[model samples]
Target: MRIFRFSLLTLCLLLSSIISFTLYAANDWYRPPVAVSWYWQLNGTVNENHDVDLYNIDLFDSSAELIQRLQASDKKVICYFSAGSYEDWRPDADQFAEKDMGKTLSGWDNERWLDIRSTMVHQVLLRRLDLAVEKGCSGVALGEVDSYRTNTGFYFRQDDQLRFNHIMAEEAHQRGLAIGLVINADQVRELVDYFDFALNEQCFEYSQCSSYGAFIKNEKPVLNAEYRRIYVDDKEERNSMCQNALTLQFSSILLSKKLDGSLYKPCR
Candidate 1:
């Protein structure tokens, strides 16, 4: 009885330590709210005039001073990068091995799908995350994260994608950086607990906005961008879209497909 009691006590202490560490890890990083007003611009000069809570800009294009300027203005900046695909224009594009490169993404030239299971790929992305840390980004917006749902000329099981995403999230947290799942709505329920937030593109147009209810219910932010012309050209479409977004508690905005600063209509 004495031995059993000591073992039980040991187990209890171990469990307590684990729970404490998990909570610490979760709270140690940044957590954006469900109602956060954010902007996503990948091209041209980043417009800083919007009364938004966060700015999502290209990771490489943004200067450290720009990140500092945004943070100084009391806005959180989420550095953007393509984690699941290889973009040839990046400075570190050559770091990806030929074997890891797959078919080109539709309508996106010079960008090819990457093998999600590559250790080398993970290392390269680790450096990208490090860059985010070095540049003082509050969080990272990982694009093309739903490679499993695309025709990437690679055989990626759902488990493979999940493992890869988990690695990215774990590594991001290890560096005290928050990360969001960009447009990977299919895995929203499974990954909501792991990611800090969700960024969906055209979910309203495609009738996929409901998938992100999981994020809102969990009190995590769902930042959606609609590029459809109807939302921009018609007042009725804009109102309906904004209504759904408001009902869903999403930080929705109408943006250009180019993602330039020329377009900005946010529905808070």
Candidate 2:
């Protein structure tokens, strides 16, 4: 009887230790800093020798095999998905409820804003995160999360946006993946704290790049994309952008409007 009691206690202690260690290890897995080179176009193959730490690619456009290939080359992959908007062209577009969708995204015809407050939208996003994990993605870039600030037709307030963004971050973290926030320049101050990193579009073009310095200050990288044609045609503009990016320590890339795999240049 004494021996059996001792054995049971030992088994319980071992199980507890294993559980604690697993939890710690899981927390450490998703906390690594991200340094990504983005390729949205489908034409040219990814240049694996750019000294970049990560590659952000379209979740649907690039297959799991391609992501595995990049990882085999010792690069982390961040899968890009539109979490807060309903894109009509996506394969999973039919899954979104019509009532959960709001106004069409300004300047974007094929996409519409999603009601962040809707439980249905949350369920869809959770499935998307699950898809990311299943596809072997190291992290996720949740695009267009600032719908509340726009004319989303949902009558969303700032507090609602904050709640939704925080929930998104928490859900990503829970899945052992880092989440990046792609927000307009105006909401950076409010949403920066909830995101692991940031993906900003045309901040340099608008002279709002300085507003995102907080992320760099916190040792988090800010990946900026510029879509201006001059950056590609004019050597002078490219030089200036490169110099500015180098000084700011921000990873900047000039991409075409199509987001097809054509990368003009990278500002290191």
Candidate with top TM-score is 1
Worst 10 residues of 1 by lDDT: 1-10
Q: Which residue segments of model 2 deviate by more than 4 Å?
A: 1-26, 30-51
- Report the poorest 10 consecutive residues by lDDT, candidate 2: 34-43
Candidate 2, residues 1-268, lDDT tens digits: the string is: 4554458889999999888867853574443353445444433455555455678777777788888988888877888888889999888889889988888887889999999999988988898888888888888888888777788878998888888888888888777778888755666777777677888888888898998888887777788889898999999998999799878878788988666655556775
How much is the lDDT of residue 125 in candidate 1? Answer: 99
The Cα error of candidate 1 at residue 207, in Å, is 0.4
| Clash statistics: count for each candidate | 0, 6
TM-score of each: 0.90, 0.85
